[model samples]
Target chain A: MNTKILRVNMERLTAEFEELPDAYRSLGGRGLTSAIVAAEVPPECHPLGPRNKLVLAPGIVTGTSAPSSGRLSVGGKSPLTGGIKESNVGSRFAQTLARLGIRAIIVEGQFKEGYKLLAVGKAGAELVDASQWIGQGLYASFERLEEAFRDRVDICGAGVVAEMSARNSGLAFNDLEGRSTRYAGRGGLGAVMASRGLKFIVLDGDGAPGVEVEDKEVFDRGRRKLAEGLKAHDVTKPGGALASYGTNVLINVMNEAGGLPHRNFSSGQDPRAEEVSGERKAELIQKRGGVRPHACHPGCIIQCSEVWTREDGADPMGVLEYESVWALGPNCGIYDLDTIGELNRACNDLGLDTIETGNTLAVVMEGGLLEFGDGAGALRLLEEVRRGTPTGRLLMHGAAFAGTALGVTRVPVVKGQAMPAYDPRAVKGIGIAYATSPMGADHTAGYSIAPEILGVGGKVDPLDPDKGALLRGLQRATAFIDSAGYCLFTAFAVLDFPEALEGMVETVGGVLGTPLTVDDVDAIGKKILDAERTFNAAAGFTQTDDRLPEFMHLETLPPHGHVFDVPAEELDAVLRDG
Target chain B: MMEAPSVTVRLFARLREAAGTSEIALQAQDIRGLLDALVAKAPSVGSELLEADGQLRQAVTVMVNGRNIEFLGGLDTPLRGGDTVAVFPVVAGG
Candidate 1:
């Protein structure tokens, strides 16, 4: 098997291929990216400085025919969190890179000169001058790149937002339609890529060797078992919850649970939230001639993505995720999908993380920059980011930086990273995950909301403050799935069906030619998380950093009148001994 | 006579589509009765919400006044007049 680690030295403008070390042979996706970042990058180095490195890797089963398994992990020291971070995304970009016989791509060192594009093909890899592409929005930049490169090439890059080295910029990957929408959209990894002076990484897999699977029959068996579970489950099956409504289904679900954060995390519920819901989105999509139940990548059966469009069916914005919708919608007091869709369009164009962008706007509004619920004002503020104005810089540094600058008291963040759509007070289990995740308040790090609020895995009290052990188990298992590169939505089925979990293990085992049972998930996942934790600890993070904002504890959210009352000891318990 | 705890039932996602409306009102004293009334009113959605043995399907998530029935009293949780009851097929997303 060709396990080649491609090392790109930006300062030298050189690309070299190296044999993957035995230590990294078994790791892939988040596991591999975090492993490389922990090993090669200095703990104390400035995130945007010369010493920092960006690592991108496809998950173990990413390139295979495994269903819904096309997640790419982008890892680096985060300028936003000042911790080791792995931002994950789903797109054809991952499958293309993996098929080229590449195990991982390590982008290292800074390039003071203008940006360069790294092109990898069956022939060889080379760096081309990409100065002209710099300072352009991702929409225009991706369009031009598509025209410049062959149709087979999958394009990925940091957009204009990254040119300013903003803390909220994400690395944008092309979706199935060649739109620059899919993203590793958290932890300011795009700024790290920008700092490396690399605007784009284009992978052309034409005529290249595909993924190497050691045991074909075993892989097929596992894939079949998983496919059956997905096909049978109410949430993952076709015409089921996810396929019918897309992930925006959660807008109503979370709102009903009183877990949906509104207006900068001040309240948990908003009657207006249903206005931008997945159900509503689906109806509009049908009426406006947009595509629903769409896949972000090939081989994805869940299809929890959609093409949101204008009422007249003119401009097509990519998927409005539950997080994106809530972040840009009710969280900003803007109920209209058009306003939120435009906000999402701006985020995609600028290559900024929508979750961070929404929270920044909320904090900015709370600081008196605009009134709460000002959708027009929110639209105007994004222009500042394009212009790279002083206010825009503050917004791009993420919610914590903006909240601090504005002296806003209720900055809802953990480790300088803003919280997502779910409020911890209403959905207590996810709050624990938020506080303890190595990635800084990322819901995907440990989504206990499945059990806590949605009743997917198993029913649990959303108000319960005693989930330390449960959160730990969830976080560990999540690390494994993220490493496997399965869309996290697969967890909806995997949780309810034991066969699916076993099937997941077998798929990875089949790919690597190793014997992996369901029993091995915890230890394997823990090893990956241990690497990230060790890096964070070395970078000066303490147990104190693993805590929700003080306001969560002090203030009670309405509707449910719940506060985040999980004990400090419990939060500490989740991350320790990992 | 006074109304039999006239609670409003809100459906979501698949349930709403199946029922052909987002909200419905019915008189029921407890969650079990409300669900029974719900099925009687919207049999298409009712078939999805209840199992063969008449137990609430595992996929159905029920919350009353923004609180899950699990924390309150499960199927027997009482409904009062003017209360809002939310139900769905337990969709999952981060």
Candidate 2:
């Protein structure tokens, strides 16, 4: 099946279908998103202006019968970072779009008059009036869409925060239960979508053409190999670490390592971390009769997601992950999982990025706007965001902006984006990743925690500063994995099992009708990273933008008593070609 | 005879569930001795943390006082009273 690209010009209110460009035929997921943004978008253009474009693409094997490959990449010039950004999410929407033979959808230009929703179906695409959803939160808006568009269709949209043009907003997608919980929640891409007058996007995938595999034999063999490896591995297997407790399992481990950032990076470990840990969360879910070992997308064997419910087990919230737990739980000094879950649900509804919102809330606490560990106060602040109050708007600009506004000099940010759970001062390799990532302090950019804390690939001392080479290798490998549309969690199996790694690459090659070797995967990763770095450089990012917060260098984290002492020269050498 | 050094053995994730507690006080002088005591205390944890040869499992990470054994003296890392020994199985997420 030939791939097609959808170009929607909101200024003209026109939707055009074109053949996939030859230059971009091989690119998919992050590779495709970054390549299009780098080539088409001007580096110095205003991120929320008509010049910026939002490009959405699925992986090469996303729609195929490959396990855990249904991730989507949304890229644009970030209003928050003023650089190239690709935010990723796992949802059935990616598979639906890919099955409709759409390789990428580039939304450009601006419609200042009113809001519109882009609807894509088997026949073609069209723009519809979305005025009613302009200022609505995602939960209410998605419920209305599910009723209007029929529950069988997939949906993605910006929330009320985006409607307010908040820089910390993100794009939300539907989970398996048709709830808008999954998000491409970083880089303020939702503001870009809102700026283009696109409130939501609906996909009518019923009776759509499925992905066509060129070599069924090769695809099946590769799929089988990967499936076997995923089942055999201790961490990725059925009833394994992820399946048993979900991603929150890391809370205890990170706390024990003295790497779980608590109270706005002032400390690394909290005595109450176990209250929000994966094990505790799982126990609560099991006792409350909630679902565990849930899959985020169809054909996902890992089943790391879970349906968390309230105390009485009546209301089913969304899936909970480690990052959300850390950012909203311990980072804010709140140890209760219920409060974190409520905060996470609020962020999902308001179309805000939970990580950024959590960081922002921590900054507000540091500024004495609210007391730390106040779950009720945090919930009230989230309500303010929904209401679009002045203080809420200020907080919605992300932690860096909030920190600057509140005169909090101990802000933990790199390149304007808030750092995630792991304190760089404690986990030094991830610190290097947070500092040097092209996406601005993104944990997923490199994820050195795999080796540094988890011992998934190989054990590395979390406090060691001699990890520039290790971090660089992990970042390159992660780029390739993200491009392939596989869940990052799958790396736990593929890194250790050689057959699984070969199987992932071979499956992509089989789908694209091209031969791909292990070496070629590395090459693709390097090429993608080079494109991103070049784009950031053109956007005026200097070496200074690639350093951690000043406090990280001066303040020593407790337990380990280590500061971020990684040399500047070593950091500069991380992404340098061998 | 000298009194055995007391170390705090901390378990995380599935290991904690297997051990039925987050931490336990054990009397041991080295990392291996602590593991032996841990196995005696919680036999179910031994299967996941150690091999039949009494060596640390490749997937298990053993850290003493917040320092990984690989950076210290491996399984022979000396233990002292009140030292915190954290044992975790291979786990990861983003």
Candidate 3:
């Protein structure tokens, strides 16, 4: 089976398949997405303009029976950050696309005529007019699509926020149960899709040309080795920390370490943190007869995903990840899981990135638009977005815009993107990552919380200032992992198990029909980072754009009473060698 | 016959759930003595926190006065009255 690039030109309403370019043959996922965006898209072009191409690509190992290797990268210039952006999400849509012998789908030009949906299958692909589905939430649109096309196909699309051209909008992908909860939910890529007048993309391939492995013997060997490592590790193993409680497990741990951001970064520790803790959440789910230890995609050994249900076990609100919980819960001074769950559902329905929206709400609360810890007020704020009210439109533009509009100087953001769960003031290494990563305050960009707080990779003092090198190394390694299509959670096992890391690298080699050493893996990651950084540089991003918000340096966080003290020189050193 | 000093022992995550309280006041002179008193006070938490050989479990991170015990003296880290001891199970998330 030969991999092909599927190009959909909304300008001409034509679908064309091109042979994979030799330069892009070896690249997959973020590597391919960033490479295509940098090479084809003019950096100085408006992010939501026709010149900004949106590229979606699956990882190298996707569509294979690789554990947790189902992540898809969506790349484009970000309206939010005004730099290169590669937002990733885990969904079967990526695996299905890979199985169809498609390496990447590049959506270019603009469809000024009307809204349309691009459908791809075993036979071919087509662009169908979809104006009827306009102005509807993603859930209603998806339900209608599934009813019309049958439920077997995987669907991905933008929601109402995209229609409104909200900078904080994100693309949503249907989960295993057809809930549009999984999202490549950052960097305003949804608005980019909306700019092209593409409402949704559906994959309905009946007889997919499955992924071809060059060396089955080597692939099987490496696959088993990696799977064993996942099973052996306490964190990734079945019924372990992740499986049992999901990512929300970090609530109490971060609260205990005084790294969990609370009340809009005013404090680190929240006395009511346990109310939304993983243990309590899991208990509540079990009591409500909801499903636990769930996998987001097929062939995933680490079933870290779960279904959160209402009191009567009706209306499953999708998987509640740690970042969403923290962003909606303690960040806004609300601890009730029901409130967070409702807010999460609202974000998913409206197609707003939860992290950005949560941060935006906190900023508005700080600006005195609403009282902190007011769950009802927060729900009403989300309603304002659904109604497309003027205030909702402002809030939907994300934390930076809302902060600027309200004259609130305490916005916790870097390069326009809001930071995630871990407060950088306390978790110093992550602060370096937040400041330096091209993705703008993305925890998954480096994830120093593993070493600093969780003690996974190696123990780093959470308060240490001398972690520039560590953050840089983690960023390099993570770039490779993202390009390879493995879930970031797999790092917990790969870092501790040498053989697991080797097996993962070897599996890629087996799939590509080439011999790759550990050195090659590092090169691939560095190459991706270089491409991203070069694109951002050409887009006019300087060292100043790579720094955290000014208030982080001025205000000290509570509990530990620490400020983000990582030197500017150290932040600049992150990608210098690359 | 010296009076036993009281240290505030803080539990987080699953440990707090197991102990049914976030903080516990225990009488002990040092870190080891504190653990013994803690296990005696909450028998259900002993297996979760300590191994059969009486060593702290690998998943349990113990900190004395906001400093990791590994940086200080491990289980031998001395604690004075009114010192805060925080214990947590190794947890992670993105």
CAPRI quality level assigned to candidate 1 from its DockQ score: medium
DockQ for candidate 1, please give it.
Answer: 0.79
Candidate 2 regions off by >4 Å? Answer: none
For candidate 2, lDDT tens digit of each residue in A1-578?
Answer: 44799999999999999998899888899999999999999999999998999999998889999999999999999988999999999999999999999999999999999899999999999999999887777887888899999987899999888878889989999988988899999999999999999999999999989988887778888888898889988889999888998888889888888889899888878779989988889899999999998988999989999899889997687888899999998999999999999999899889989889999999999999999999999999989888889988888899999998999998888889999888888888998999889999999888888878878888777777998888788888888888888988888899889999999988988888888877887678889999999999999999999899999999988867889999998889888754
Per residue, candidate 1 scores C-alpha lDDT tens digits across A437-548 of: 9999999988888888888888888888999988898999999998988989899999999998888889999999888999999998888888899999999999999999
Name the 10 consecutive residues with the lowest summed lDDT in model 1 chain A. Answer: A569-578
Q: What range of 10 consecutive residues in model 3 chain A has the weakest lDDT sum?
A: A516-525
lDDT per residue for candidate 3 within A1-578, as digits (tens), equals 34799999999999899999998887889999999999999999999898999999999899898899999999999999999999999999999999999999999999987799999999999999899988888877788889989887899999989988899999999989888999999989999998998989999857998888887777787888899999988789887778988999888778877888898888999779989989889889999998898988888888899999877889998999999999998999999999999999999999999999899999999999999999999999999998899989889999999999999999999999999999988888999988889999899999888888777877878888898778878988998888888998999999889898888988888888888867787678888888999999999999999899988999988887889898898889888854
So what's the TM-score on candidate 2? 0.98
Question: How well does chain B match by TM-score in each candidate?
Answer: 0.93, 0.94, 0.91
Residue pairs in clash, model 2: none
Q: In candidate 3, residue A385 scores what lDDT? A: 93
Task: Give, for candidate 3 chain B, the lowest lDDT window spanning 10 residues.
Answer: B58-67
- Please tell me which model should have the higher DockQ, number 1 or number 2: 1
| lDDT: the better of candidates 2 and 3 | 2
